[model samples]
Target: MRILALALAGAVLGATSALANGDALVIGNSRYTAVQTLFGAQRVAQAASALNAKGFDVTLVQDADAADMRRAFGEFAELLDDDGGPVVILLTGAFVHSAGGSYLLPVTGNGRIDEAEVLMQGFPLDAALAILSAHQGRAFLVLGETGEDPDLSLYLNAGLGELDIPHGVTVIRGPAMDVARYAARDMARTGRFVRRAAIEYELQIEGYAPQGQVIVRAGDVAPPRGAIDPPLPDPFANRAADDVAWRLAQEADSAEGYQTYLDGFPGGVHVNAARQRLSALNAEPFYRERRAEEDLELDRNDRRAIQRALTILGHDTRGIDGVFGDGTRGAIRRWQEETGLRVSSYLDRDQIARLQAQSTRRAAELEEEEKRQQAERARQERVFWRRVEDRGEEAGFREYLQKYPEGRFADEARAVLKAIDAQRAEQAVGQDRRDWTKATQANSVAAYNAYLRDWPNGGFREEAKQRISQLQLDADRVRNSIEASREEKAMNLNFVARQLTERRLEQLGMKPGKVDGQFDENTRAALRRFQDARGLRVSGYLDEQTMVRLLAGGIIGIDR
Candidate 1:
């Protein structure tokens, strides 16, 4: 309940537009009698400011009384009207989670509040999600509980509550779940980490639609550069660290805005160094030189590059006019910090040369690295299959399938199996020698086939090439085993497959006849009909290829 320090700090500017764009509220309810409330207040204020500078509409309510807490919740509920975003809600307090539900004692309230005052003293997850759903935004609830607390799972089992992240809720207990931890992820500029943690649980719920909507990551770690950016407007209420990191990693503009962020935040954490490095590069004449090269194809030359450099430096470039005039130079210098690089408007050859070289190297390195990784993966796959053949082919293959479901060697394995089985049939009397020789020559291929035969449900699957290799041995007895499993195992239909089949049949002149909970012959017929109408190859099967086309055609409105 220590969110009341706003009285001393003055009402911080609520990033009205930023808040409205993607609302974030840092609620530091430090309810412990030992820990001072001001600590939570300051942390919330800093977090809110950091997020607001990054274009988030943030409200920092520190050390709030119960009435103030309720009012803040109401304001947050209003933010969901237009933006389907994640409204972050942080709580730092004593969490009394009984059979009824988990509750956070308001900071100003006494720690001894009994069960009778649970609803009044604490905010419930259901009420929070309901409010968030009504507002069109997601809710992320981060509960940083202190001291010796009961296991939340107890409450969960007793029907008090469950931590269903995808419903846009994340519940974290223990004083270890601090504002600094979240600040670190945000500082590291990783939001997907936070987003993933928020939504991962609900994504696994029995009947809940696993939209895989939120990206959640926990901890102070930063993701590798150029990793997939988290989805924007994260649909959760209170995000963990990754959410904060991702929000702060966003590019910004204006000297004043950046300076305000720096002022409020003295420590140069995750992004501070990146910002400084960018600023140093920006101040150097060569930074503009690289931009000029990248923009050389465009009509504007030096102007565009200069404007870009200035923007990167957190300077406002009215326009990239090519002319390195006073306005542009002044803006660049204003954006400069403690970097030793001399402030200059003119693009110098040395700086330009270095940036161009670095850029070229980075681009080439990225491409080559991608190719190298792909090749290495291919090589490993070959090796893995080879080992599988040498050992228990079926076991090797099964394990491989589990590890690499869409592996390239999948087809080869199938082919090897066909060959082995064929050799067994041709020389059914003494085909053992052929088996040893084939295993030695094409171990990976042999392993793959064995995997397909035994562990039909294994992660790795046979591709077109492997199936083609097995084409000659169509009548193999193992084929029946493979086909039999697909037919009998009703649970084989993946979530994507089920949704696609259901939605497509519903749209077409057919009412989805009992999603009969399985991919049976009826489902195949429906799939074939849909494929035939679309002029696609209709094999009366829903293969990955078919699923891809279905997705491309927007057969089902589910976001990919």
Candidate 2:
């Protein structure tokens, strides 16, 4: 049991020595739920160290329950009374007195230390006395320091007054170690020694009760290991402007001692005094250099926690030793840069917060950008297909296919190009029919031959060949008829075209009197008769209207 967070009042000079211990028995019990348990193990460690230094073989047990503590005390009593230096049985825990017995608690004791059954569960002073009296060794009984019950001196007087021994049984109570009841009251005697001054000063400090190791110096052998004697020799007692800093840096052997002192007492209450002394002792350089080195072990763990947090934020701290070395500094700087802060090798609370904020923002931006790019790509695809469709030709389809061979509409574009080529082929066939019709109306072998030449494998190729065969036999005949018509024996025809018209009119019931390819009088007379019969003015010359009507009436065998 020890003071919580704060250090105890030091020895006036400092505890440098103690009475030599033979076989020391130290029992620390802190597991009581009914009362305050021991908060820290430092006191137990300190007591053990002091006794071990005095050449006593020390056995320490902590957090022990009732059975384990009883077993320990029984073992202490067994080895304690017989064959060693005077025994020091130091017990540190919760203490209570009821029915004239002092009870030192263990981990599992029911209710309060004052109850009779609870007293049975604890290690009592009477058991300690029985063992000391049984061994031949004069024993010193010690109640060690704890946070609760600093004014517990009456537990000793009440318990011992009921025992069989003389007042020679020396008892010690520690760091608070008060025995004012034995010295100043009815249990008073010239025999008991106590820390009157330190105890008085400790009582003045608020909140926590003061308790310390006690010593009994009545025996001529040596002083016992409790707080009855004056406090031990302290190296930093004279250096104490502040009570805690000396214990922390000088006494507790902690590196954080100086730094923690400076942080808390920066108003120059303790720091300025420490600095003045540092120069005189030439310890300034040592502290300056080892300040970080001597920090609490927890500080290193703290650094590792910070590094792990940074790692989660995507900054690599390289290692986690809790020290802010170059790698850690660089990580901090990088994080500061990413979060849009001034680049630096150090970090404070504000920088860490912003780093997290900026990381979140960057993630959101990247997601948004991805969505935008996807939409743009889709729009481009739409435009590409539309351009290809609006042209609606082979080239338009081919352009789309070349650009986007694996595009969404690639197969459809191929199908469209095939359809366009088929339609063009069908249109070319219709033009071939019109050319054949014009050749048939010319009614000459040359015209028929020309039609066959143009459409060698066309649908009208057979018809053109048959007409050419018929016209080739009349080449001489047509010339003779033309000669006759021009001599006025028959009307002259312009060519075979007029001759064919005369033949068609004659077949339709007009006497043209000639079947020659010339614009003769007979051909004109037949044309007028055909026009008159067909409800037109009998113009002697063939007219455009008459030709159209003749062609429409199938009199002219031109292709429809």
lDDT against the true structure, each candidate: 0.44, 0.48
lDDT of 2 by residue, 70-94 (tens): 7666655554534445555667666
Runs of candidate 2 with Cα error greater than 4 angstroms are: 1-21, 34-39, 109-119, 134-137, 144-165, 174-560
Residue 383's C-alpha lDDT in candidate 2?
Answer: 98
Clashes of each: 49, 36
Error of 1 at 520 (Å): 39
TM-scores, one per candidate: 0.32, 0.28
- Using lDDT as the measure, the top candidate is 2
Judge candidate 1 against the unseen true structure and give its global Cα lDDT, from 0 to 1: 0.44
Candidate 1 residue 499 Cα shift, in angstroms, is: 38
